[model samples]
Target: MREDAESLDIRDVTANWVNAAVLDAQIKERIKSLADLAHTPLFFGRLDYLHDVGAEQAEGAEGESFYIGRRHVHDAQGDPMVIDWRAPVSQPFYQASRKNPLDVRLRRRFGYTSGELTAYEDERLSDPAEAADGEHTSRLLQAEIERPRVGPMRDIVATIQPEQDEIVRSELGGTVCVQGGPGTGKTAVGLHRVAYLLYAHRERLARTGTLVIGPNASFLHYIEQVLPALGELEVKQATVESLVTSDAVPVRGTDPAPTAVVKGDARMAEVLRRALRSHVSPPAEPLMVVRGSRRWRVPAYELEEMVRELLDRDIRYGAARDALPQRIAHAVLVRMEQAGEAPDDRVQDAVARNPAVKAAVKAVWPPVDPAKLVLRLLSDARFLAEHAEGLLTADEQQAVLWAKPPRSVKSAAWSAADAVLIDEANDLVSRTHSLGHVVLDEAQDLSPMQYRAVGRRCSTGSATVLGDLAQGTTPWATTSWEQALLHLGKPEALVEELTAGFRVPREVIAYASRLLPSIAPGLAEVRSVRESPGSLSVREVTTDTGTLAGPVGAADGGTGAHGGTTADAAAAAAGDAAVLDACRQALKHEGSTGLIAADARVPALAAALGAAGMPYLSPGEETTAESRLTLVPASLAKGLEYDYVVLDEPSAIVAGEPDERTGLRRLYVALTRAVSGLAVLHTTPLPAALAGAPTA
Candidate 1:
């Protein structure tokens, strides 16, 4: 197959392209695509049919045998050696079963280790004797599920279940929102859907482009390799922050929860519109055009009429401003024509650029920079009141106003919330570019304004919204997927719920689901198929002193010191030691490990890990071959998974959140991140909800 692919002449395809530069780019792209499949398995499954399904077979053809893989592979004669997983013929490989085997008589799955096929398992659908071997199927599935995850996320193309295949193969023209519990493969399904969409609609998607938006840089890094492994690398990936704030200005910090909630509210859209339109005042003077010293004046009434018409048309601010000068010039030309003077196109062009006309146009419809306008509205109380009078309450308006606002827009220290606002203002001034499709992972955590920012980019396209409502940790998180879909501009999109767990063990998932009632009362309990008895462990920090555990350290290399009694300090110290012990135990496992803690405890825990010579990656850094452990803050641990996870103080994680429900939701996310096992160590007593669960 490799020799056949290499022998194909690319020059023959683009024979007319004599330009070396253009040819080089095209050849480079093709080489990259072909080379990507080298590191991945060529094929993982095989399907044998009783008849040649749809193929125009040769005279001597007996039956159709297809090897399913990530991409297509051809022999020297262009005969198929492997079929792309997204191909129509490959559908039965995943959807086929004993009861409804379609045309497949026998199914074979290959076990791969380091891209080498090591073993193969078979399921004979037609033979009753072989069909009774359920143990064989379970063993293969379990081995694949328990495979050590040491680096970035791998594509699960070889093991996609029937349910997952349905969502992945959904049509590309409409949005599909998936409410999946932890370890349910929702994120993987969303990614594979993107790959499938690209394969199914290559030309259309290539013209507008597709995107995958994850929760953070770390989460993005974790799942970044899946699409490329599936032979789809052209998909763009980014966090909401990176996508929305592409302006030159740098974001400085985050807004307070209350302020952010207000800014993120949908009401801010109307307020911004009013504030921007308020810049257009009544035209007090007429626009005069002097074309070659013959002054042709547009009366004040006509200028006001033009402004009113433009405003009423609901066009963009910048668009209206640009058209104002041309409208006035056309009016002046009309007056000249009524006077029996035939003025050509050149006269109107000259009048439009005339200094007098430009000044009058500026006075009536002055150009407004989105950033400058937002800054002015935030800094000036009277202006904010005029625009936000009916939209926001007096106290809410006060909360939204910046205290000691920046002297100018350039010097302003913009927060993440402010960046969304600026994005909204920019779109109001000018249209935002649309894409073909977008996959929004962990969509439940995005604020309304952030959703708006994401929505505009895909306004003309569609989206795959993947998230768990129970995992929402943000202050402005939507209470339901319906509300989230509405904010995403896909209110009518189909909402699919996936509650079966395929990654985390059943014990670990059941332990984590204890928090569901407290955090998300309406959500149905999640169920996992794999039952690993000792997957969950919760140890109380025992200390001789009042402090719960040893000398604690912050994630940033600081002591976990608090002004208290000597006994209290000792217990705190003891609790720190317990956390390290938990980490040490988890490290003994066969796969990647994560030490997750609250934002406040992260610095202390990081210091402890560093002092203990346990090198760990930060939130945005990927785990490397040399290091199998990472220090993750609870806030950024939403979409990340590890083989074994050591959860720090649960009380502290809860305390770090804005409210009790949100805190529990955050804790729920941290708990379900482990793929193999989980050890939750805490000094303080467990949250009331989890107290009834059996301890390790």
Candidate 2:
């Protein structure tokens, strides 16, 4: 493939320099995409049919054998060596079964070790002997799911389940919302859906563009390589903050919880609309245009009628303003025709640019700077109260008002929520550019207004929303996917629930599910398919004076600390020592290990790890073979995973939140990050919800 791309004669094929440059660039991109990755397999599965398939299904050839891979690969003779997984012929590889083989006689899955083929498993779907044997489970599939990781996330193209394939292959015209639990592969599904959409509608998406929105920078960094690994390189990734705010208006301050909630309400969108509309006023004087010694006068009442008509139409603020001048000039043209003078489009355009007409349009519909408009709405109390009269209550309005407003947009300390407000105002003034498709991951944490900001970007396209209701830790976390979809302007989108777990072990997810009733009462518990003995352990560490006394089992009654604290400072040191011990024990295993703790407890744990001479990396830092330990704050641990995890003080994690329910949700996220084993070490007693679960 690389040789074919390099051998292209760009200069000979193109007649002009512009076409030559475009062809050269295309050739370069083709060559880059064909580069072989050392440790990534070109193909992972094979399918054999009972008869020759149709030419359309086989991509211009009738074939019975197809090797399914990440991308299409063809030989010099133009015969396919491997079929793209997104192709129609490869659909049966993921969707085929014994009862409905989709005409497949045999299915083969290949296992690779460091990119070299090591083993192959075959399933004879058409044989009656295999049909009577009962359902088959692929050990190779389970092994691939249980494989350890040492860096950013990898694509799951080789392990996509049937249910996931349905969502991935859904049509591009409609939206999809995956209400999945932890380890349900929601993020992976959303990403693969994007890859599939790109493959299915390459030319359309190339012109319209696509994007992936994550919860935070760390989460985005962790999943940055997944798309590229799947042979997709044009998908853009960003956080909500990055999407709304630019370098010109960097976020430098934070709002109080109550203030942020009020600012992020959907009601605020209306308030901004009212505030921007307040800039338009009735014209106080007539518009008079002098064209070639002929003076035309437009009455003030007629001009006011034109302004009211434009406002009633509810077009964009900028668009209406631009149209006002032309509307006035059209009135002047009517007088010209009535006066028996011949006029054309040139005369009307000249009248529209006349100083008198421009001034009247300015007086009636002045230009509005989105940033300056938002600055006034926040800074001027009288202005805000007037627009927020029917929308916000007295107290809610008071909560969102800045205590000390800045003099200008450049000087204001903009919070993340405030940036969202500015974005809304900007959209009101001018329509936002729309993408072809957008994937919003970890969406439970977004507020209603943030959803609107994202919705606008895909207003003309579709979206894939992925989130777990049980993992919502924000003050304004979404209560239901329906409400969230409504805010996203895709209320009719299909909502699919994924309950089967593939990443987290059975024991670990079972233990984490105990908190579901407390955190998310309406949601179903995640049922993991993979089980490993000794995967969950809860140790109660005893703190005696300044020294650590040792660990007791979860069932044992060990009175050491309550409410995540000790009676003295020395006892706290003993708890830290016990956490350190857990980390050491986790490091003894394979793959990466994470030490997750409450946001407030990060400093103490960092000092302990440093004093003990144990090197560790922060969250989002790529894990290495020599350094596989990452110290993750509970706040940022929602989307990350590790082979083994040593969690500190669950009570502290709960106490760090603004309220108990949100705190428990945060704790729920920290509990499900382990892929292999979880050792929760705490001096305080476990929450009542988790105390009854079985432990190692």
Candidate 3:
């Protein structure tokens, strides 16, 4: 190829790319395409098949070898050097097992350091003696999983487990919901599935596009690189907040928990529907279209009949409104024909746009802006009562109504809950464009209304829903996967569980599992494949030195004002300093360290860390090369991990939550984020769920 390019005439297009000559747009595009192949691995692994099953397949022959990688590559002669992992014949690399080898005899995995292959491992799958365990947990796989911390998340194409591969390669037609424990690779599987779908149906997907929705901006930023690394740079990624209101308007305030819960219910969908349709009023007199010197009139009864027909068809508000004018004009045409006049389609169109006809259409079928409609619903008591009479109780309705309504939708302070409501109203007014596929991560934390908003984007498509039931830590968190699936408009989706964790050690997972029965009783206990015996530790902090005594809480667990108990309250009142020491100690050993505490304790911990000359990053920001310590709020720590985690005051973390169950779930998430070890420093007694367990 180099020789050919060198020998080409200076006027040739190939020479243009090399000489930076002006050329057609197609020539420029080819130049850009060639330039994209400079970096990244060309191939990562190879598969040797037993028979000629893929002989007729493109770039495949009898007993031939295939190199698998993120994307396809070939020589100048068109002979393939690396096959895209999404190709049909590359299935055995991920799905092959002892029970079903898929005619694959040997598999080789290559280790790359800075784009150069440093080592390789070979597994002989055809030999029954060597494949009995059916375990793909090779040393290289472990090394990839435990690779040192770097930047944003990367693709796990080389070490996908058989079970994860099944989910990743599931057919693109149906929805798949995965219940994965911490370190179960659910997020990676979800991203890879999107890449697979785009490859299998590129033309169809390119037309509609795909989306990946995470819980927060930080979580999205952490995974923003996965799809692009897989050669899918066009895939869209956003959080629910950014996808809904940030794209439409700004959200600047917050609502109370009870009000948010009410607004996020699926029942709000019905109320919004009634409120929007209520704007359509009956025509006052009639529709009259004056053309040239003649005038045509359609009676009030006929206009009413036309409106009724459009409304009953269940069409979108804008579509029905636009069609009303044409219907009226069509009626005028019918009258003209009966009166012995010849009128054409152009004549009807002119009549439809007439001033009288447009005024009548405006009166009978008015247009609505979703933001203004939502503001009106929340501000006007009478209007809200009339529309929400049957759907919401009086108390619930009063709770959602704004105390001092803003004068305009633009000036109004919209909360996240209000943003979701606006999205619902927008969908009712006009149809939201559907996508080809959507991957929703940490889905258990979303409200039903949020799910509905996501559902509308993929109504005609499918989804890969991923979350851990026990990690749900919200006031309106879903109680079951079935309920979540139903709300996402994919109730028939297949539900799969992944319990074998590879990141969190066995001791750490078992220590965290004690809270499962109290929080999510229906979920099975998770088991970890990495068994580090001394991974878990608990230290009791004392306040005698007037130092590190964490926050105390009520013993009876009552959280609404009166408090639970005297000692517990006293313990919570006195803040702890031991948490800072633990953070300092954990930073001495390894990769990345997180100082996790309750949302309220964040200020104190940050001050302490800063005073001690430790620079820390929030969970929302990416970890840079200079910083090794991060101060993570419990709320933002759901989908993050670190090498060593320093947890401060379990009781205070629990007290900050609205309820005990949600608090326990948050604690569970915090406890399992460590890849190496965890330290629990508490001034007060541990929660009942973890009180009886061994300390270290």
Candidate 4:
């Protein structure tokens, strides 16, 4: 054959990609053998699947569904939402956001308020979950989307905050802090404030000099589009970890291979780098990891020895340590001893006052050195105080390593930007504070110890805080944000209680508000603002027997057994059957279901479902709802929720301090992810406190 076959068609020898020979033979066969083919279409129908929850087979009866093989599909022609951005009320908003970019009012109003809703960044808050009809906030979001992103900053102006917040926004201080609660729009206002800072101080500080500390990667994904919606680029965004570490990982353990995940890693890294440059570094700090990093490792020790160190050791800390209040100085010593915690010398110098530390030290040490305790910083080894407070995660409080930061962590910390906003400030360790400007989110969720951590990060600048004091949950819930507020140097200056509700429907918000304890009535604003279409429903099923343990009688229960009695294998089988049945029902919902087992060994139960031929999305897999069962270990479920939640625990044991401090919150977050439904199948009856919790 010639090098090029110009005259000859390449069908006969080529692959079966439908050549003339195949087509002709097929058509001939169809014409000769087929009868009454005119009614049939030319091609077979095809289906597109998106979620992990498998479809129910039609074998089941009405009102009762079976996941035999049938599928569910989204309505292709669902109503397209419209918001009037051209309206005059929305014009100023469009102008100001484009001018100032992410003007505070617009960011909070993005979901809760609508005025000619347009794109502020790259996302649409349009959702059926929100109230029907055009809300002023939603419309504003629309206007941001619809308006041209170019032009001077005078275009959209929306003042969603009260005069006081606007005033707070206007203030350009050496250091500033913002605090409050969830749905109070702290994160929204803070993000918008960054745009405002860039607009106001761009000439002085330069856009490159601004840094915005943000939450984790999932949260970054959660809010990634907010900036671009206003026709502005995402300013420097960094997680608190990235802000702290010279070389931080983006959502640890993700692959570095090329693709969307890689791009996200780069974005996370770049934003963090930019934030560091803007706040900590005069120039971009070397994007390389520093060696021989020292960290403080704290563990549980007898309170007696902690006091000796406070009086004797590095109490001669960075200049400010000289001003340490006796109470805090003492408490730090005690926590170091009894709690096996270490003094964050760096953090010690950062706060204006650390009363919690003072109080804790006083409680622990009381200026007495008892022969009963041995506390020379507990110098064995397994525990690394890497920086400071992360040392608490240890179960057995093993040996201690003296991790001294070489060249000072602050040298690099302060090497970047002058002002710092620590996202999730409450989670910050006892150490790691030092900033000209500081802001925090979810302040309501912080406990007294965490509050002290917040205090340590504040400086002389305006300390603006955000988070709903009413949104507090967990044992660490700030019993008194106000009393906690009094611990601040400027309590009165700290009184910016945001009254707007942006995330939940008034109903859902109201429903959640019921969970708030009466102690923090301050969150009544969110409850009052919540619009509801929610109702609580309950279902009961007998426990499964066999392969199951009995209901442990609660200490309060009348039974002599502090735990509930075991009913035997039938109870276990019944409860397992109940969960299986729930999973079947969960797969039918509009959203996905999450099955939280006590540990990773959920196969005995999960394998049953798989043996039933149900599809499943493995935990930590790129989860889509179409699969049958998605198993998630309770630990990995922190900060994430599912559409449907099923919690399975063979034995519900409330164990240890560390789990209570952090693990329970993870359990709570996972339990809250169900948007539509929740089913708890337990060998134990489950805690009464969680019985009627919100289904995500």
Query: Which candidate comes out best when scored by lDDT?
Result: 2
Tell me the deviation in Å of residue 156 in model 3. 1.4
lDDT of candidate model 1 versus the reference: 0.84
RMSD of each: 3.3, 3.4, 4.8, 22.8
Residues 509-610, model 2: lDDT tens digits? 989989988888978888899899899998777644422332221112223232253454456566878888888998898789999988777877788888
Q: Once superposed on the true structure, which residue ranges of model 1 sit more than 4 Å away at CA?
A: 1-19, 36-39, 55-63, 126-138, 292-297, 332-351, 544-558, 562-566
Q: Candidate 1 lDDT, tens digit per residue, 291-378?
A: 6657777788988899999999999999998898788888988999998999899988887888898888778888888888889878
Q: Mind sharing the TM-score for model 4?
A: 0.43
Q: Write the per-residue lDDT of candidate 3 for residues 476-567, one digit (tens) a residue.
A: 99989899989899999999999888888888888999999999997887778887777788977664454333353233232211244554
In order, the Cα lDDT scores of the candidates are 0.84, 0.88, 0.82, 0.38
How far residue 517's Cα lies from its native spot in candidate 3, in Å, is 1.0
Candidate number with the higher lDDT (1 or 4): 1
* lDDT of model number 4: 0.38
- Give the lDDT ranking, best first: 2, 1, 3, 4
lDDT of 2 at 167: 98
Per-residue lDDT of model 4, residues 149-251, tens digit only? 1111111223334432463345556333444433344566665555455444545434224444433455444444444433235355554445533332122
